[model samples]
Target: MIFAIIIGMSLATMIPRVIPAFIVDKLQFREWVNRWLNAIPYAALGALIFPGVTTVKPDEPHIGLIGGIVAIILAYIGLNVILVVIGAIAAVFLLSI
Candidate 1:
């Protein structure tokens, strides 16, 4: 019974997702629409990460802000992503100390 319920739930979840991929595969979007679609992941990532960045320390929110600023500057300077993330982590760690 448990196995049957799990299989039913999996099918219900997969059907909606799998159907869209098959349906959209044959469709051609405009160039601008394609560009917008490509940007969705980054936009979604920022929306998700920004809140966590701001609340890293409830009493001292500025530490998180400073870390975010460091990350932005490193990214703007074209540093590697790993370096940018490490720099941000280091900034926050130092500030907390």
Candidate 2:
């Protein structure tokens, strides 16, 4: 029963992601639509990050703010995403300690 349930859960999670790539690949999008679609990841990242940026440290919100600023600056300077995240984490860690 547990094994079957795990397989069922995996299939349920996989289907949505797998079906979309197949469907999207067969469709033609306009230039503007493609541009909008490309921006989705950035938008999603910002949505996920902003809340944490503002409240990562409850007692001292400034650490999060500093880390967020470091991330933004690194990203704007064309650093890789991993580097930007590492810079943010480093800033927060150093400041918090």
Candidate 3:
């Protein structure tokens, strides 16, 4: 059982990296797929952020998440990244406390 668990974890860790390297060379996704791939990170961020934003109380919610949304918007508009990150962190810390 221990061996199986270890093998399962190893496969879980390896497959994500291995699948891309193996498949990228052997297969071609269509242009539509390429476009969809560009949105995957945003989808992942949504998956992570949605639960946090919706689950917690207004008083003790994930303050960092709220600040991140603002920083992301500002960065999307081409603001300086360093300042945006600093501002986000500061906002979250102050608001949460």
Candidate 4:
């Protein structure tokens, strides 16, 4: 039935994520490994954001570039993520206008 299919899909999506956390919790990582893992999120974020930066405003990449630069500077200065995102959007909107 539809309910059973939905449950199955949810379990399929969750199990992979849940199993890794549980398994990794049981293992002890070396200092280098921990440092590498700590860097993963930042690296992933940059990877995700870089492309969007280039394509955010296809008609005017300059606006996106300006926004992205502001976002990066705000982030580097340890601003909150929400503020950084808001600042970037505001910059882009103002520049576009």
Candidate 5:
């Protein structure tokens, strides 16, 4: 069933994040990891932004524009995730009207 598959994948993912610590203790590596590891977050951020900024709906503001810029600033300040999401929603609501 789909549920089984989901559980299997969830465990598989959980294993890798935790397994590295144990495995690394058993081995040694002098070489650095692929830089792609570090870039994924920023790359994902851009992926989310590009379309949002380029496409505008009657109710939605352009991504990376004023609302998006404000969201980015709030995020940069490390605001709570729930608050950030709510703030972004408020911004959209206000700007759309």
Candidate 6:
């Protein structure tokens, strides 16, 4: 009974994830739809990161915002991603101290 329950739980978890991959591969989206879908990851990443940036120093939120701005400028300038991240971290650290 325990083994059966575990297998059932695995199937339930896997099905939703697996079905999308198969379906999306077989589907052709309109150009606008494709563009919208392509933007989702960046939107989601910003949503996830924005909150943390704001909360990095609750007493002085600007430190985080400045850090985020530094990161954005570095990225816009086409610095390597690692350098962008390091630059942001350095900005925050220097500002905090």
The candidate that wins on lDDT is: 1
> Candidate 3 regions off by >4 Å?
1-11, 53-59, 72-77
**lDDT of model 2 at residue 50?**
76
lDDT of 3 by residue, 1-97 (tens): 9999999999999989788877788878899998899999999988887766634346655564678687888788888989888877777777767
Expressed as tens digits, the lDDT of each residue in 1-97 for candidate 6 is 9999999999999999899788988898999999999999999998988778878889888888899899999999999999999999999989877
**Ranking, lDDT, top scorer first:** 1, 6, 2, 4, 3, 5
Off by over 4 Å in 5: 1-33, 56-64
Tens-digit lDDT track of model 5 for 1-97: 9999999999989998998778867765444644665677999989988766645463544632666677777889999878777887787668778
Arranged by TM-score with the best first, the candidates are 1, 6, 4, 2, 3, 5
Q: Could you tell me which 10 consecutive residues in candidate 6 have the lowest summed lDDT?
A: 48-57
What tens digits encode model 1's per-residue C-alpha lDDT throughout 3-23?
999999999999998996888
Q: Write the per-residue lDDT of candidate 4 for residues 1-97, one digit (tens) a residue.
A: 9999999999999999889777987899999999999999999988988777878878877788889899889999999999999999998888877
Which has the better lDDT: candidate 5, or candidate 6? 6
* Candidate 2 lDDT: 0.91
Question: Which prediction has the highest TM-score against the true structure?
Answer: 1
Cα distance off (Å), candidate 6, residue 75: 2.0
- The digit string of per-residue lDDT tens for model 2 on 11-92 reads 9999997998789878999999999999999999889987777789988888888999998899999999999999999999
lDDT of 2 at 34: 94
Taken over the whole model, the C-alpha lDDT of each candidate is 0.93, 0.91, 0.78, 0.90, 0.73, 0.92
User: Candidate 6: where are CA atoms >4 Å away?
Assistant: 1-19, 25-32
- Model 5 scores worst on lDDT over the 10 consecutive residues at 55-64
lDDT of 5: 0.73
